[model samples]
Every structure is written in C-alpha cells, then in structure tokens.
Target: MVSVASPVRQSESRGSIEPILAVTAPDMKRVNDLILAMAGSNVALIPEIAEHLIASGGKRLRPMLTIASAIACGYTGEAHVKLAASVEFMHTATLLHDDVVDESDLRRGSKTARTIWGNQASVLVGDFLLGQAFKMMVEVGSLTALAILSSASAVIAEGEVWQLSAAKRMTTSEADYLAVIDAKTAALFAAAAEVGPVVAGSPEPVRAAMRDYGRSLGLAFQLVDDALDYGGSAADLGKNTGDDFREGKLTLPVILAYQAGNDEERAFWQGAMEGGRNDDAALLRATALMRRHGTLEATIERARHYGEKAREAAASLPRSPSREALLSVVDFCIDRVS
Candidate 1:
C-alpha cells in the first residue's frame, strides 16, 4: 500500500456521505444526464424499466468512488465522467438481475421492475444496460479500465449463479460467504475505484490503493446490510426487513450464529434455513437466536473492522480533496450500523 502523511478522523461525516457528494456533485449530474440519454431505446420497455430502477434513490456510491478516485489521483479530464456512468450502469444492471433472481417485491422503497414488469422484461432490460455499459467503456478508450469493469461484470454474474446453489445450504462456511460477496459486491467497487487512477495515468501503487479502499468499503457496506436484515428497518434497507432470513439466505450472521451454536441451536438453524421453517415465527426465532449468540453484534463488529481497513486504504492515497471524501465515505458506511 502507498503511504500517506496523516490519518483523517473517521467521525468527520457524522453518519453522512456529504463529503463524497460535495466532491462529485457536478460530475454526478453529468453522469445522471448521460444515464438518461443512454437509457433511451426505441424498444420502449427497455428504457421504461431501466429508468424505473435508475431513478430510485440510491446514493450512486460506486460511480462516485470512480469519480473521486480519479480526481484524487490528479486526473483533470472528462473521461472519468463516462467511466463513472459506466460503473453505475453495471451496478444498476446487477440490482435488476438480483431482484429477478430473488423474486423480490421491493427495491429502494419501490416495487421492483420484475414485480411491476415481470421477470422476462427485467432480465432483458438488465442485458440492455450491460450492453450500454460496455458502449460507455468502449467510448472511454482505455482497455485497462474496460477490462476491469468487464471482468467485474462477469464475476458478479458468476457470484449470482453460485449463490443460487449455496443459498440455504447448511454447509456454506464463512469463507464461502466471503467469496460470494467479494465477487458479487466488491469486484465492481474495486474496478470502479481502480479505473479512476488508471484513467489518470497514476502510478500502479496509487491505482492499487484505490482498489483496496473500494474493496474494503464494499465489504463493510454489505456486512452492515446483512446485519440490518435482522436488526434494521425497511426504510433504511429499502426492502422488507428479514428479507434475507425469509429467502433462506445464509448470510454472515446466520453462518456465525450457526457455527458458534451448540447442538440444539444448530438444529434450530438447520430447520429454519434449510428445512423451510422460514415463516414469520421462524424469523422471530432466528432473530432471537442470533441475538442470543451475539452474532448480530459480532457481524457489526466485522463491518467495523473492514471499515477501518477501508480507511487505512484511503489513507494510503496521496493527500487530496478526493481522498478525504473517500475517507468520509468509509465513515458513512460503517456508521449505518451505529
């Protein structure tokens, strides 16, 4: 990792992403404009569903990371705008596909495109976004950036497929769970952050530092989310709470709770997770058990550890406004649990 002059206090954001917003707001508007233009298609339904998902209220953190990373590395060109938009397209495409696969009813506090438009349309539109994303990448004219984002797309797809079989399987270990999330969630983040430095023609050390920061932040973000399934609200999560529990997904808290439990506790988990005891009562019991085993708190602690790693990675970057904003994002992500 590259070394930095000093560490920024993690409390600067006070549970907000305002630092990132400040640095990327103008460029973010451009990214959004390009997204609107690119989302247009004569197919009608393609744009309809794509816009439906894109207009929802995500912070667009991944693309912002791309923009911020580039700017932090002393990049002063318009290429980062296209790359940031491309990163968002990749993320939005994944959410569409994930909703279909999970058979989910809600996303970002709105009806999922699949729920409103049916699964076939949702999948096809997701493909359209991928095509559009690649078009933007090609326009950027950096094969290295193109390769990173494209490979992340493929890895995310593989992770989705891998999760289908792994979901609710009692044999899924903590290591297996990490591998899944790292591919599905962190790969794109790494690419998003790395692309910024790559476009700036920054040194490889700086590029790698950005990737590490993004990867750690992604892991921390997802861990907080997984913990929220049992401990947080639907308003914050943008989906029904306990959604993971109902789907019989073996997230980190579930895995840890099951592993640390005794025979009876393990049996309870097997029945709830694999034996289809995932009704309301089962969800309550599962939550209780997680609390009893301290895994819920444990999961949040895990997120904090990763959050610190993210901060450390951000610290390695050269001092810049973007670097400080990235550090604040690390704080914002970890603060979700608090």
Candidate 2:
C-alpha cells in the first residue's frame, strides 16, 4: 500500500516521471535544443503556441522513453538524439490538438496554448510541429524508424476520432475503450521503444521486447491517469479533478462502474452521463458509486496487470543500467497512485 504520508508533496508532482530525469538529463537538454531550433518560425504565432505547451510542466516521458529504449538496446549514435526530439515534437503537437478537441482550459497546471492563443493558432502550430517532426524523421535517414513513427501518428489520429465517436455513449464497451487507447496513446510508446532498436539495428527479439514493454507501460500510465482524475486532488492531477467527467469522456473507471451497477445505479449513470451533469454533487454521487462498487480499486488492479506485463516484457533483455531504469519506469507509472 502507498503510505499516505507526505500526501501534499506526493500529489504535487509526478514521482514516476521524475526518476530518470538525472540519467537522461544531458540527452534531454540536447533534445530540448533541437526542439527549440526546429520550433522557430518567421510567423510569430507559431512559435508562441508551440512553446507555450512545450514549456509547460509536462514530464517529457515519451521522448525519454525513446532515448532510454535506444540506450538500452545499445545505441551509440547521434540519430537517437534527433529521434528523441522528433518524438517530443509529435507529443507536443498532439497536446496542442488535444486541448482544442477536449475544449480543455488547464493543461499541466497552466492555461493551455489554445486557451491563451485561441483554437486557430493552436491547430496551425500543431500542424507546424508535425511538419517539423516529419522533417527530422527524414533527416535521420532510417526507413524503419520513419515508418514506425509515421504509422503511429496516423494511428493516434484514428484513435482520437474513434474516441470522439464513443464519447459519453452508454453503449461503449471495454473492448472499444481499450482499442481507443491502444491507438491513441500506446502506439507512440510502442513506436518510441521499437524505433530505438531499429536505430540500433538490434536483433528482432530485442526489438519486439522493447515494443511490448513500451506499449504496456503506456497503457499503465494512461490507466493511472484515469483513476487519478476521479479519486485524486487537483494537485495530484495537473488538470482539475473530474475534468474527464466534465468533458463527458468515458474512461475505464466509469465504464466498469456502469457495467457493474444495478438498475437504479445504471439509471444514475445514464442520467449523469447522457444528460451531461457535471456539478460537484453529481461528482460526489459518482465517486460514491465507484467506491461502493469497487470499480476504482478494480481499475488500479488492471493497471498493475499491465505494469506486470511491462516488467515481463523486459525480462529477456541483456541486463544494463538503461534496462533497469526502464523497469523502474513501470513501477513509477503504477506508483503515481501513491
């Protein structure tokens, strides 16, 4: 069990995202330099919107995944640096676009770029970053790495559209939910880790191992975020608590809760979800329902299952510091709930 000791400090920031910061510090700086250089535009609004979100308090975990995966697979070239920057740019662009789609104001505890600059600017800047990301991928001159990331980009878009269709629909199933997140979130993670081995020309077994690890880790990360959005303080979640509820997004917690609930409980869920009720009282009732049904606890247990998959995926890799760090990353993802 996670000790509730130091709850204030623990909830203030993400502990899992903080650990490898030291090990990846130097490489992260290089990635940042590349990002800054590539983000520059003659048009003033482009840089403003891009930098606003980029400079915000995100963990940069995805790019670090790319870097760490490459290092673990024993890469020793400058290409991974550019790929890391590319991964970050893709992620930032997605955030810019996502804020617009979600109509969210706060992101990473700050006003989103779209909130400050408006949706038009946010979208255009996101496109600009995507263009820059492709340019970097081309510059790296690796077809395998390029294919992995490019396909992931397409899959992420598809996932978002699928989620858009599924939003707040009472009929949305767990299988549908998993499919959405696998495309939307986990694709890049799998690509991020696999591209490392691709860049390193590692054997197929190692490449497959890294891909599995990253995909599982990404699922755990997102699932933890889902749980936190309901049970956590606003400080624990960079975004406001119940933002997902307010947004009418159907995450695993609510999906499971709805499925397990009875006639009256199902009626409550339908009214709240379909009617778009997002008040504090409604949220209290929702939390009470989740607690009573044990859905919240069940969701966390599901996350632990994925975390175990991540660990098992790494079991066959040749032991190294990078491998150990990647393993710890899984625990860190799970530990965010603490």
- Which prediction has the highest TM-score against the true structure? 1
Candidate that scores best on lDDT: 1
lDDT against the true structure, per candidate, is 0.86, 0.84
Give the range where candidate 1 is weakest over 10 consecutive residues by summed lDDT.
Answer: 1-10
Candidate 2, backbone clash total? 0
What is the clash tally of candidate 1?
0
Model 1 off-target regions past 4 Å?
Answer: 1-13
lDDT of 2 at 197: 86
Clashing pairs in 1: none
Report the lDDT tens digits of candidate 2 across residue range 1-338: 12212331223433355546766788889999999999999998887777788888777888888888888788889898899899999999898899899999998789988888899988989999999999999999999999999999999999999999998898899889988999999998888888988999999998999899989988887888888888776666678878888887899989999999999988888878888876788888888888777777777777778988999998778888777778878888877777
Candidate 1 local Cα displacement, residue 10, angstroms: 12
